[model samples]
Target: MRRWILLAALWLSAVTPACAAPPAPPQRILFVGNSLTYYGNLPATFAALAQANGHAVEAEMILEGGATLSERLADGSVQTALAGRRPQVLVLQERGGDLLCLGGRQRCEQSQHALQGLAEAARAVQARVLVLGTYQANAQASAALVEKEAAAARQAGAEYVEISQTLADLSRHQPDLPWYAEDGMHPGPALTLLDAIKLHHALYGMPEARTLEIDAPRYGANSGLQAVLRRADAAAPNAGTPPHIHYEHAQVERLVRALDHAARATDPAPATPSSAH
Candidate 1:
């Protein structure tokens, strides 16, 4: 009787849903941001995501921890560095902090100018430029700002990836989710990388990992974005939200339309100069 019971228990355990492990996410990305973008070894997340999905991807981070676009713009050397990489995708998360926290519409105007420069630089190098919309501790960014940022990207003919709201929603549910570090101004490197991947997947339509582990790990899922998630989860906590992670459908559709317009404007054109992260 005891032997029979043991066999039955083992069988039940094998069939339990709890026994199934969640599949790892994909990764492979290039990220740009302030210190909030670097601290947590976000690059590692991308590496892990790639490996989990049987991909071996790399990431290049061009972030000036704690410094916003204003600082980077003042320095004026990122453009040169960007030219050398000619990355597949160039992500730009402007606003060192949140717009609301800064206390001025002037900053928003400044951000617009900086974005234009970023777009030109990216276009020069023929890289896809992604505008990262930031999240806040007090609350997510205003939909107006999201629209403005997306519009700015559209005008410059660049891609748009809004991550702030997604991270904010994640924070709300996973209360302990640390969107920013102790400074409350920057995203940990790990989280930054994760955001990069998630946004890319959303924009480029990431697929599931269906490649056989034995294959050369061809492009199955989004290598660029999944790598970001892997790095964040390993280096930082990944608190994901639902559909609203970025915005309501209406806002997302707007962004999508902007991206399409940008694509059309730049289509059949040669790459432009490389810009900073």
Candidate 2:
């Protein structure tokens, strides 16, 4: 009886499950930038893409038109967001002029300082930092500035998303897609969708695919855009393919359009002399 009991106890112990590793906490991301980020409804689009890609993400934005990183820090909005939200990721986007204008390198230094300050704050809160490489019409200047920003991110121990490079690559690969909006600064719908896709990939380590596309027939000409369309088609619940897989392409387009509206309405009003901090 004792031997049999010992055998049974051993079997029970072996069968008992080890404590499962805790599920990862839900992802929350905060985007801090000027008009470029807010205009395209980038954070919202990113959230939509993440949901479509099997990850739950919450995205919030602090957008001040033409605000530099130093200005944002001085304004204290980003600090408040970081403390209050304590997001998993903090994305920093400097204004385009600050990144590209090489007048005296003053803007560049300010940008670098801003990155460090943001990175340090994020580190304290145990959140990851992601810096967006600024993009503007002047591709040469844009590329140079992006490289510098990327270096700053690396120095600060943060990941840098090369938005400029992605745009350049897209322009080369699919020249037909409009790169910029009418203002010749902010990204258009196609570029905005691309940004969302790249952000999703950067955050989740997932490749861009057809099933993960935002709905815009205008952008459907390119292979990159087509991939997302395929994703949308594949996951359409109405198509009667898979009962569990469902994606609403219209929802994605709505988010994109809403972002565009927000961007348009908030066209950085001219700063008063006193208000130009």
Candidate 3:
């Protein structure tokens, strides 16, 4: 009877189905901010950069012109966006200065509150949060604010992408790099591309990786913009030298034109140069 029972147990074990492992979630990232994020759908560009570096990623963006984190938190847009899509990374950015934070005590407290709220939301969704350093038109004025924000972000347990320093360097090298639109306030594709590359490096720990090209189709509905981006991507620093990251003036102009046209299509107002940030 013992031998028979052992045989029956072995048979049952052999026939039973094994427990299945849950499917792995897609590597998703969500970018939340104002015009700085929206213009080029930079999150998508960043994802493309990552893909080029052999990482599969999905990126989304929440953009509103001249919006602040506090405003977004109050509007419920941030929460709604995060509910269904539990992203692996949540990127937060705002305009150059504390336009919405007001000033004095209010500015400091409100900024902290918003960051806290954002961090909490990210935590609930099991996502890491990243804060973009402030990029001002005057690079000189950026240092102090950037340092303050970087420390605050660290305190909030969020990584800070120091793109402002990168931008300042590039702008100094190529004074007319078309980093900003005619208004000078918003970023053009060239700048956005740099941001994408920088963000990719920061996220993947591959600062030296240098493939700056991405599928132009992902730039969205503007064919002119797509063509411009494709052209720019094709123009690496050196020909037959293995695609080094560099920018050309012509490529920058083409991208700026594409952005200008797109911006004009929505608002026929004449373009003006705003601050670089």
Candidate 4:
């Protein structure tokens, strides 16, 4: 009897908040980004998180790589082409490859323009704005970019959610954090998990956890079936799929397979982000 009581206490401690749920909801979200964002499985991370937490989710990511927010906003390109559907949130981040443009004369100005466009879109669709500040790189490392984006969001009366820096802080120690991918352009699998963890902290009030994607389309069109764990994004709304797919016998056919491997191999998936609110 006493032994059983002690075991229950230990189990409860293990499942407590910090070791429990993160604080975000794995709900409907839309990500607007470039190649890096695509690789992170931006939408699928949330979807995966929802599954972990025993919830259903819907998320999407629009391909806009190498194009800064300013560039994407121009010509009503990204926002205009969204098919007029507004999600609960729109995540905007600078192009990872654009790190080379950091400190350039036009960086700040371009970011501002992009912020304006994002604000306009958010307003038009009644959605919130999640500014994915620049990732950690030699030239583009600074809280200013995030601050400026947040300022613009506030000015425009848009709610903001920050992630880059927090992840940076976490990455400083874990060098193998997968902050960079093989291309040296986008974040590898780790960053996506980190983003999901942070995002959970934002939307939910649960404990915290990072992820390792088990499934994905391909590392790139050619990276092959590697053991990477990034996030996955959903196709655009009302977006149709290809005519057919072949999944007969692949060593590792898709990202989902990788996730399956992870679940079978390592510890269980982190609990879903907190969904208290």
Worst 10-residue lDDT window, candidate 2: 220-229
TM-score winner between 2 and 4, please give it: 2
Give lDDT: candidate 3, residue 271: 44
| Ranking 1 against 4 by lDDT, winner | 4
* Order of the predicted models by TM-score, top scorer first: 2, 3, 4, 1
The 0-to-1 C-alpha lDDT of every candidate, in the order given, reads: 0.50, 0.62, 0.62, 0.53
lDDT per residue for candidate 1 within 1-277, as digits (tens), equals 9999999999998987685676643323556655445444444343443444445445655554345665555565456556765565666777544344364778766766777787788778776777766655445345545666678778768777666555554555545534565666556432444453455354443313321111111111112222121222232222331111111234233333443444446464633322223
Question: In model 3, where do residues sit more than 4 Å from their true spots?
Answer: 1-25, 99-104, 207-277
Write candidate 3's Cα lDDT for 1-277 as tens digits: 9999999999999999888997555477878776676555576667766665567677766655666788877877777767777777888886566622336667666777788798888888878888876676565667766776787688778888776665776677667666886566777767887677556645664322333454432232221221011122232222332222333444534443443454467558764432110
Report how far residue 198 has shifted in candidate 1, in Å: 1.5
- Cα distance off (Å), candidate 3, residue 207: 6.1
Candidates ranked by lDDT, best first? Answer: 3, 2, 4, 1
Candidate closest to the true structure, highest TM-score? 2
Query: lDDT tens string, model 4, 47-137?
Result: 5655555555566655543556676676565565344555666666666524334567577666666777776776577666666655555
Q: How far is candidate 2 from the true structure (C-alpha RMSD, Å)?
A: 14.1
